[model samples]
Target: MTRLAYSALSSYSRVQIMRLVQDHPGRTITDLCDETGLHANTVREHVQRLIEGGYLVAETERRTTRGRPRVLYSAATGEAAASSPIARRKAEEAARRGDLMRRVLPWTADAELPSDALHQIDALVEDLGDAGFDPIIDEGALTVDLSPCPHASADGSHRDVLCAVHQGLMEGVLTQAGGPLRIAQITTSCDPSTCVVMLRR
Candidate 1:
C-alpha cells in the first residue's frame, strides 16, 4: 500500500485501540485480541502501531503468582495528533476558553447540584450566559441545554446555525477546561422557530 493509505489505516487502528483502552484501561494484548476478535498477532501489530504513534504506553506488572510479569497496555497521557493547522488552532482556542472557565467558575468547590453531571451543566450554562448566550440549563445525562436568540438568524435554518454555534461553543469551553469532558449525549433539534441544544457534560 501507499504511504498515505498505510497512514490512514494506522490512524484508524490507533483510534480503535484508544477506544478499547478508554473502555477497559490496563488491558492486556490477550484481552484486546479477545475483545476485537482479531488474531493475537494482529492485535500485537495494532498495539505496537499505537505505541509507536505515541497514542499508547505499556508497563509490565507481576502477578501474585511466581511467574514472570505480564505486559499491560494503556492510553498515553497528553494530547495526540493535532497535526493539521486547523486542529492546532482549535486546540489553542479550546485552551484559552478553559483558562477563562478556570478563572470564572468555582471549579475548586464541589457544586451543590444533585449530581456531578448537573453541576458541570450548571457551570456550562453560567459560563455561556456570562459569554452572552441565552441559555436554558437542563439536568440530565447531558448537562446544559441552550436556546440562543432566534431573531439573530439571517437564514431560516436556525437549528443548523445554532447547532454549529453551540458545537463550537462547547468545543471551546471544554477545550479550555484542560481535560476530557465526558459528553454522555448531545442532541440538537428544532423547537418551533428556535433551535434547541441538549448536552450532557
Candidate 2:
C-alpha cells in the first residue's frame, strides 16, 4: 500500500475537499459540490488533483435500475489514515492546550494591582525568566526569547505552558489598566532561539 504524501497537498480548498472525502467516502462529484457549496467544475478540479496526488481513488459503481454506471470518488483510506496521524495528534494537542488556557486566563485577567505598569511588566519578565524563559521588556513590548527553542527541545505539551503564561501576563496588565490594550503580533521563526512579540497600548 502506498502512503499519501501530506507535503504534496497544498491550498485550503484541496485540503477541505480531501477532508470531506475522508469523512464521507464513496461520494460523487454532485454530492461534494452540494456539501462544499463549490461549483461542480471546481469540485472536479480538486478531486482530480487529489487523485493525481494519490490522496484519493476513483471507481465506478453500477446500480441495478440505473441506465449507466456512475463514477464514485473516495479517499484512499489506508493511505489517508496513515498520513493523517501526525495532523490528528497535533490537533488533539492543540485542543488540550486550549482547555488549559481557558482555566488560566480568568485568574490572570482578574488580578488586582498596586501601581506602576512598568513595574508590572518587570514582574512578568521576572516570572518568565524564573520559568527558564529569557524575557525582555523594552519600548512597550515584551519579548520572551526562549533559550532552548521550545519547539525543538520540548514536546508539543509546552505550547500550553507558553500560551498560558503569555495570556496571564497580558490579562494581568490589561485588567489593572483597563483601556485599549493591543497585542500587536506574535511570531515564531524557524530558528527556535528567535521568537518576536510586538505590543502597543
The candidate that wins on lDDT is 2
Question: Which model scores highest in TM-score?
Answer: 1
**Which ten residues in a row are the worst by lDDT in model 2?**
82-91
Query: lDDT of candidate 2?
Result: 0.51
Estimate TM-scores for all models. 0.38, 0.37
- Give the lDDT of residue 89 in candidate 1: 38
Q: For candidate 2, lDDT tens digit of each residue in 1-201?
A: 332333324444565666666667778989988888999998898887666544567778868895887778866533333232322332233334434553687443223322234333433343344334555545324443444543345445644344443443343333332234445666776655566556555
TM-score of candidate 1 against the unseen true structure? 0.38
- lDDT digits (tens) for residues 1-201 of candidate 1: 111211312233444555676556678988887777788887888877655533356778868889888888865433342122322333444345545665688463334433333334443554455444566654333345445443344445543433343354354334333343544445544543344555433
Report how far residue 137 has shifted in candidate 2, in Å: 36
Give me the runs in candidate 1 sitting further than 4 Å from their true place: 1-14, 79-201
lDDT of each structure? 0.49, 0.51
